[model samples]
Target: MSNPNYDQILVHIIDYVYHTPITSPRAYQRAHIALLDSLGCAVETLAHSAEARAFIGPVVPGTTVPNGFRLPGTLFELDPVKGAFDLGALIRYLDHNDAYPGAEWGHPSDNLGAIIAVADWLSRSQAKDVTMETVLTSQIKAYEIQGIFQMKNAFNKRGLDHTILVKVASTAVIAHLMDLTEDQALSALSHAWQDGHPLRTFRQAPNAGPRKGWAAGDACTRAVHLCLMAKAGQPGAPSVLTTPRWGFYDALFGGEEFMLPRPYGSFVMEYGFFKLVAAEGHGISAIQAAVELAKKLQEAGEKVSDIEKVTIRTQKAGKTIIDKTGPLRNPADRDHCMQYMVAVTLLKGEFIEGEDYADDSPWASDARVDELREKMVVIEDEQFTKDYHDQKVRSGANAIKIELKTGSEVPEVVVEFPIGHPKHPETLGLVKEKFRVNMQKGGFESATVEKMIEMVEKDDLPIHKFINLFAKEVPLKT
Candidate 1:
């Protein structure tokens, strides 16, 4: 029997992947920056987080795949599935990679886990002429697919994690990289949709933990695995999205179809947030406001103890997601907590870093941080919410107001765009600097760091060559 017709969403995605050519210079430029920045974030995770390192590498020790992808910042050479997981986990573990905010917020760079792994492995094993340019193109496409879906879907509101988009985006792009036909690509994508999506519970209070950090990695692994299955001749559920009771809509989306607000393109890569600081995307502006408020307190000779009350006015999404007020159990919990991030910034008079969220970090145990958290109130600003969801003006606006014990109110500090926003004047420079600092923190020498940056800037570097620059033989901790 002839195959049934594919869903329009699947058809659109496969068509974009196969026929659409990415000619936007801005998209290419942003993809290059995102590549460097994401790799830098991965290296930084290797340097700072033992918990993250422990989760990487092959499932069985002392096993290696021929012509496998080499994970950056380590000696492990893994198959594409494990490679995707390791790379994705590293980029996302600290939650410092770039993010695209919309009805559903997620880090578009999370797709890099699958893109880089599949490209690098294909280049090595099949002798395919995959270059950094190809990788960047795939990155742009993946970001566009995931970002566009996020623009109109509130997966979190349905109690699903946004990594569901990551899985779908990565599968579609990886299928293209693997040279799967449209039918196979559709089959792979259908499998991705049919796969069970993890709940958002791991990212919320009472259950927030390391699973939130590695969720994207898990998605990337599934993407690679599903594509490989499709390449091996698996058939697709053509109507997976529109199937009556068991379809994606009815089973997971409350019987509502996904709304694509725009055509697939490079807009997401060009406009996504960089996340220079180590806080949740929604709370980055709040952290900036808190840092500024801390400076004001220091200038006025006021201590954190003098703050009688603190009011944080933020977007509705921010209030819904990151406005936590209880004991944070881990880095995953703390980083997502607006109260924790703001409290740490207020106490230190500096922006919160990845180290600040560590369990052993002084700030994590400081009673003053909790005291400040107790004094702070988070409220949703309707205008901020509207701005956050506006396609023309995607702002994660946050305002902080402070009242002193001495009956004086500090002028409210409002940070509408945050430092990493594209509209911010210093975003480009800071993004580059962030990559440099991350490389240095990951233990690369100054000259080596410069060389890596230069290599990443080049358009024709082979995928294997560019990926190998990040590999070093650090003895794995037992």
Candidate 2:
């Protein structure tokens, strides 16, 4: 029997994976940076987050797969599926990885969890000859796939988390990495579409918690699992996206078809934002604005205690996602809450760090933090909202004004772009510095950290050898 016609979306993804060749030198350069940056973020998570560390081992302790992938920054060797979860969770736990803001905001680097796991596993077990070059190419393609989908699709508005894109993007690239035929790749992608996606509630107030940290890991795990199933001869639901009432469009997307505003390429990687400061993508600018205001206060010998009221102006997406005015339950909650981040930064007179959001951190329990939060008002700026979604000008703008108790008002501080934005002059240097700091914190020697950075630039470095550099046996805290 002839095969059924697949949806254009599925066909486009499969074709891109098989046919697109990454020719952009800039994309590869950024991918190299992204790879190291993601690993550094993972190391940072291992160093600071006990909750993230608790989830790092295999499903069953002491169970090991021969020729399993080695998880960076730890000695755990596991099959690609579990490795994907550990790596994904570690890279994303702190919300410090790179982010792409759009109709649907996400971290494209999240797909690196699946890409690195599969490539390392294949090279070790099957001797597939996957190299750093291969990994970079895959990273570019995955970023393109996820980033393009995010450009015009508003999945969050439909109450779905953005990790659905991570799953689909990872599935496509893993199929190519495993040398699956086009038909098999289509099958894998169909399964990704058919899988139930997590709700956005875990990222919102009153429900925000640690699950937000590992949702990408869960998506990467599912992606690798679906690819394995497809490799084992699973059949695909050809029209999973468009098959009437039961299709993804009708069932989950409210009958709106997914949009691809641009063709598949390296645009996402080149233009992605790195989180130099550990906060939600939408609130990075707000945090920067708060920091600027805090600096002004410090220069004038003003204390945070003197501020009677704070007003934050942000984009609509920011208000929709991180403008929370309630009790933040954990690090995940605090990082996503604009008021909490701003209050913490203003209190410290510096940029917010990952630890500041931790439940055990003093800031979480500080009455001053909550008091400041209570006094703040978050309002949406129409132009900021427009610029945030505009294809030609994607800006995460936030303005802050402080009203002092002495009956004085500080001029509004506006930060249109946070550090690590592509347009920022210091982005590359700061990103490299962040990686160095995170690597050393994860137990790498300063010399070795420098060596690893240099090694990632080599195109022909074997995948397993590259992963081995991060395989230190750091003991987990009980």
Give a tens-digit lDDT track for model 1, residues 143-259: 999999999889998999999999999999999898888889999999999998999999988999999889999999999999999999999899999999999999999999999
Q: What lDDT tens digits, residue by residue, belong to model 2 across residues 1-478?
A: 1233888889888888888888988888888888999999999999998888887888999988899999998888999999999899999999999999898899999998999999999998965999899999999999999999988898999999999999999999999999888899999999999998999999987888899899999999999999999999999999999999999999999999887888888899889998899999888988888888988998899999999999999998899988888778778788989999999999998998999988789999999999999999999999999998887888889999999999999899998888988888898889999999999888789988988999999899888988888988764542
Task: Assess each prediction's global lDDT (C-alpha) against the native.
Answer: 0.91, 0.91
Worst 10 residues of 2 by lDDT: 1-10
What TM-score would each prediction reach against the true structure? 0.98, 0.98
* Model 2: lDDT to the true structure: 0.91
Q: What value does the lDDT take at residue 376 in candidate 2?
A: 96
Worst ten-residue run, lDDT, model 1? 469-478
